[model samples]
Target chain A: MKKTLVIDGAPQNCALTRTPGGMRLLVGERSFDCALETLGDGRYRLRAGDVRRDVLLAQQGDQLWVHVDGRTHAIQRINPLDALAAGGRGGADSTLAPMPGTILTVQVKPGDAVKSGQILLTMESMKLEVTITAPHDGEIAEVLCAPGQSVPVKATLVRFAAKAEATP
Target chain B: MTPQPIRRLLVANRGEIAARILRTARARGITTAIVRHPDEEGGLAPRLADDCLTINGPTPVAAYLDVAEIVRVAREWGADAVHPGYGFLSENARLARALAEAGIRFVGPTPEVIELMGDKIRARNFVVERGFPVAPSAIEADDPATFAQRALAVGLPILIKPAAGGGGKGMRIVRDASVLEAELATARREGERYFGDGRLFVERYVERPRHIEVQVFGDSHGKVVHFGERECSVQRRFQKIIEETPSPVLTPEKRGAICEAAAGIARAAAYVGAGTVEFIYGAGGEFYFLEMNTRLQVEHPVTEMVTGFDLVAEQLRVCEGEALGYEQSEITAQGHSIELRICAEDPSQGFVPATGTIHLLREASGPGVRVDSGVHEGQRVGSDFDPLLSKVIVHGRDRREAIARARQALRDTALLGITTNTAYLDRVLAHPLFAAGDYSTAFLDEQAAALSGKDEPLPLDLLLAAAALSDRQMVDAATSVPAIYAAMGAWRN
Candidate 1:
């Protein structure tokens, strides 16, 4: 299966396939076949690939932990795309909606050059602020949505000009 | 359909519900695989499973709800089935169909059942078309004025619910016309954000309604059995916090009617495996079909305790294509059972899903106590998932015994690090309204202010000890000290 997910604002096409002992995920030419199990307490066990045998295991909405070879690693995720999604409207794939909320703040404008996953707008609904982020390292081509302006799902808020291809 | 019995199982969910499923899977002699997400503070699931897998993706869409990732591991690990405990993508007909297409037996109902029951508008239409009484509601409306007027026709204090997504998200209670526009907008936004569409509908917000849910099971052979009802009257923010079997409000006649109505609907859907039909019982004992959760419910343990059956095991049997071993008549309710959702939230923070590290822990115990937790004492509670740490279930010979045992059990429980509602739950279990079994959705909302205040005078002594004892220095020293030394370190530290 393949899905176009906006991660921190950048659109990544992720494709996953099943391999014995785990799942083989392909995202931008990187593949990981991870052993997956649901431990039942909202925790799952996943071992990525046999060679890179360092099992990197975690769950959704969790703070962050990685126990590789009996060593525990604590990490925190910086959700840039979430920030863009919080900022009211910009891109189809790059802009994040307000977690299904109403747009709250418009932070940036069109022609704004943003780093990967920079917050361009913010939306507030139910008192929860969701930031919409720049999908990639690019200049915003157009800003179509505004603060306090409600847009439905799949409503285009911004457009992104992905970095240009280089000839080798 | 019984091609082979599953050897290894991949559970596709997180939290207390996932922990509960692990118990049954572990008991059945199957190897369990889990996908650990970051920021779990190294949750309890790490220590329980045979082998663990971690995913880098953090959000529900990236992790648990990522069907492709889940299915890939199930196939790679040679697990025969994936049990979606509930919520997340449990009702996602596509996920169910994906597993089916992959030749892996997805535990629970077939994709057919999932689709039939998952489409809220369609399911409501199916039941209403079949003569079942459904609350009057409207679908998508182009104009907000037309929508609110239609909603008012249904009556005031109406509920603006997302027509697509269920499980209380994207739901708003518009008490009067004053806030209808704002509530509708929020509901639509939430609906679209959560469910990929913002379409919403409105319904009569029943007053003083008892939130009762019925459990139904269907076999490969055409047969459906009712597992009585679970009283989910005690709720917070429109979600069940505490659940009990043999609702105090139900008469024998009422119970039969509610259960029968559920069974009829399940039969209509050709429901297979374990499923729940939720209903709202009105003041005069009238019942309306609220919705059907197409997967295992969070409070299944309470039903299991009263029925003396394993729901996961039953799902497995149905997946194995065996006829249900028990009939509707054979099923009987036993002793009372109650479950308190021990969550990591400050009830003071409007139950804002709490996030922090767990410094110390004491799980409740004694006879008839079951604690299903996802994270351990040292783990951090992540903001990425539901804040439910564990479901503490207690069974007793009667409701009074259960209540008393629950109170005592809750009192003995100790959790330090981030604040929890343990003290608040303790007060709730002891409250006259709770003890008297007078429960409702509004029970907490009505008494929230008073409850917070009433708790102020009762236990300075215990809270002081708990607070001082929970301090970092004391806790740090206690982590190393012997029981006697720790007792002394209470002041020294």
Candidate 2:
């Protein structure tokens, strides 16, 4: 089975292939041998590499919430076909506005390459500044907003180009 | 006039403090009433109160700040005493006077003492007049142009503080006189905007000073006693985020002197109930009076943990005209206690206040761990009020044990569906400097890059696997319900 996993809106191609011993999991360019056991109450004991963690998991709509070692990571899984049709905006490659704010500065234009965690723009709300960052290494497909423009929460601010770099 | 025993008590506040006061009041066999704003109808404080009285106004803040409405509700509810728990109107002199006029006992000090200590300039002068050590300061002059001259005389690196400000609001630090005018104007505007008072005061800024405060209690019979100091130097933007009792830096001799000074000031003011005298302790062993909080402080739990005394209960007993049952010689510190404030903020994103419904809450509970929370599951948290959701207080035999306990307790606690500083606090506790207790007020600011920076990237494969497995479980659960399919088929038009 194959899908795209979006973490904080950055998507990566993921594939799960079953083997005699265990399941081989591939996310983007990384691969690992993993085994999962149900611990009940939305908890799963996952063993990958040297780590064996009891991960608390829950699903709310398209977002998957997982708690591990006091921190919760929220990710979304998207069908590959959906990503192709939406040109990456429908899946993990879209940057949605995190809060209602006015854009103070836009750092990237269309077709610009951005590294994961690079500041894409700055937004201001309630006297505090929030730096919108690129969630993954990708080229910008489109820029939907400009400086001084007011946007609501969840408004798509920037979309990443679908990765032709990943393989099945 | 002889004091009457309070039968029913009304807490004129909201959130954790109100809930804490309710606990003590109920334990003492006193019936309790809590005023609830419209936005906080389901807040934890109201749920804990015997009588939850609604004070309706045009807005939530207005209703909470309505003095006449609060007093009227207290009278109608047959509350003989009112406890203004630490935030809204906690130090408001008008509310104290109103309660007095209504023939009700206010759990805090008299309005005169509150007014005297509530104002920074007056408090400084009052303390100075009574031969207390105070930092050299200049009150804002009538002429705006002469403000620079007065500030220069006080010395460079001066703090621009609002006279009526208790929190760090409307405060500015001018490192040099070059930008004094510009900074002064900004501070004045902020003061006027936040507090109604634009009057400013300039004082010599103490660089990297440790914030130590002594908790004092007094009664109507003119007796005052002091609890040991609590060090609150772990600050960000001038607001304390972490506090611990028996300040790590204070020596035994200095501790005795600071505590005595706090008691002396309270006795001189004829203060009643609980109050805190804050001081800015310098590295060179010099300490100066900063200001006095005329009401119970937010970090009182640390003191309670170490002293084994219920501060709220003491306030009630004092209001009932009872003398403090113990003297200074009897007060003792058992062990180290630390309090970590759990705010509804996204620390990875500049600590911006996050607003959402609390979908899940699992408070940590074990030996020596106490959780004072204002929120519960399914409660809607808007941006209208303070972002403080709860507090995690842990006590241990020593600071090292307390730190370890706090780290473990914080890890066990979980508040989902809203971004919080829980993880950030965990990292701070693990930091070597913080663990060593060799840090100053500049700890957060100096260590910002290291503290606020992103953690090592989470493996993508793990995240992908979790998302996929969780999504599949959801599908399996939904399909197992055959009635849902029938409902779906009928819904198709």
Candidate 3:
């Protein structure tokens, strides 16, 4: 089976072929023979050549949360179009993505006035919904991203314009 | 007069400390019970105890702090003694009094001593009156103006703190006199919000001082012994993240003086049971009494690793009116120990608390490594209580070997599900300043950028391979009963 996994916002194609003697795996720029064994309860013992690692696996929707050693990374399997569709929507005077994830909801629109700390949009990263808020009270110059859109890190989701002072 | 033997111990706390107390209590053949918040219904503490009692409240941690409920439960359950494992009601005078009234021994100091030392202002004054040095401080009630004037004499770089609380809550450092009033008001507001006590005090902030504390234990028979000291200078937001014994700074003479002062203060309070005297040692060896934690401390294991004395056992024996048979001269310290607090926090995101199921955990073992963890695999870590997941302590012949062992232990330790500060701790241990043992309380703050920043390039390929290995579907692929069986379509052969 062939798969493309988005790791740290970059896509890596992986191909796996089952063999009587463990399994043959091909990753970007490298290929190796590895045997995967289940220790039951979402844990795996992966032996790639002489290197062995204990990994904990959990699936949250389409994303795979992998924990190797002490570090955890949320990797999602995405197609080429989905990867291409995910673009940088960030710009100066806009809310940039704190992490690479799908925009779950956009709460603001072009020309909408927002107060400081107002929730402008929400993005889902690693199965956690993070609310993107307005840095300061301002009018929305443009809505750069929509719900269900995948965005990379530093992608601007919404642009803001400074509120005009009232002339007394 | 002989004291009542503690046949049953009811730990009025939660998490790792509770589990830790249970270990010692059970070893003594004492029946143990743990009071847990309903949210922590099946947490490690309850699972480790002989009996688990639920205390419901508005929040999970609140149940642990419910003095009336705790005392009532202890009496109803026929507990001989109540152990308020650090935090919660650990230093609460009312709980001690309540337990006493209920005819239960409180495994800590008396109510009067707790009340005296629980208040930061009162404790400082009492210690200073007893000839123990304390930081220059001024206490005021809702009068920032008066505090502002007094603080000017106390000098700039003063800390505006709540007079009745600990844990650095409602504490602010004033570098400029102009902002002292605002900071004082803010501190007072925070104090009132958190502790419901608006009383505030200003003290001369000891900039970059090493936090060296001596563990002093007193028996009911008027015997007190000091267990060296633990240097807890590596702190973040006033919470200690790393602690080690034989503070890299303290000279032999200074260590003796601080330990003696701790024992002297404990004796002066007529303090019984386990207590810790915290001191802020200045760069020039001048030290001031910080406060006395009148119960077991979170980092007591570091002292235990060096002193080879089980402090919880001592607390139990002291409350049972047993005399400490060993003298101060007999107490010995061997090897060096260091502890890293593994918290369930996201370091990259300003150390925000993260809650979720701990998917997998591989605790570090082997020589010179010890892990005191209250969490286990598949346990759901809720955001209702302290975020401290566990502690990794390592001991070696010296500080260098201890550091090396700690680094290895932290590297070997793994808690895969839910975010943690383990990687961040590894980085801190690897820092040159940390390796040189030349860090102060400001170490975390001063080196925040270097510690948190991605100093090394991301190993994307390795991560991808690991992720692929951890794919849940990979289990099916690996465990499938051979491709030939699926192709044969349920053949009897």
Q: How do the residues A1-168 of candidate 3 rate in per-residue lDDT, one tens digit apiece?
A: 345888766777865545556565567656666765778977777677666777666665456666665566667765455556665433337789876566877898988888999999987543234779999888999888998776765777888875466889
Considering the two chains of model 2, state its CAPRI-style docking category: incorrect
For residues B230-262, could you state the per-residue lDDT of candidate 3 as single tens digits?
A: 999998778899999978888898889999999
Better of 1 and 2 by DockQ: 2
| DockQ in order | 0.02, 0.13, 0.15
What is the lDDT for B24 in model 1?
82
Candidate 1's TM-score reads 0.72
Worst 10 residues of 1 chain B by lDDT: B459-468
A-chain TM-score of every model: 0.40, 0.53, 0.50
Worst 10 residues of 3 chain B by lDDT: B484-493
lDDT of 2: 0.81
lDDT of prediction 3: 0.81
Question: Considering TM-score, which of the candidate structures 2 and 3 is the better prediction for this target?
Answer: 2
Per-residue lDDT tens digits for candidate 2, residues A1-168, read 457778866877665544445455555556666767887755689776556788766555666667777677768778777667777433436898886666878999998999999999988644345779999899999999999786766789998887775566
RMSD of each: 16.6, 8.0, 7.5
Each predicted model: what fraction of the native A–B Cα contacts (within 8 Å) does it retain?
Answer: 0.00, 0.17, 0.14
Write out the backbone clash pairs for model 3.
A89-A156, A90-A155, A90-A156
Instruction: Give the lDDT of residue B75 in candidate 3.
Output: 86
Docking class of 3: incorrect
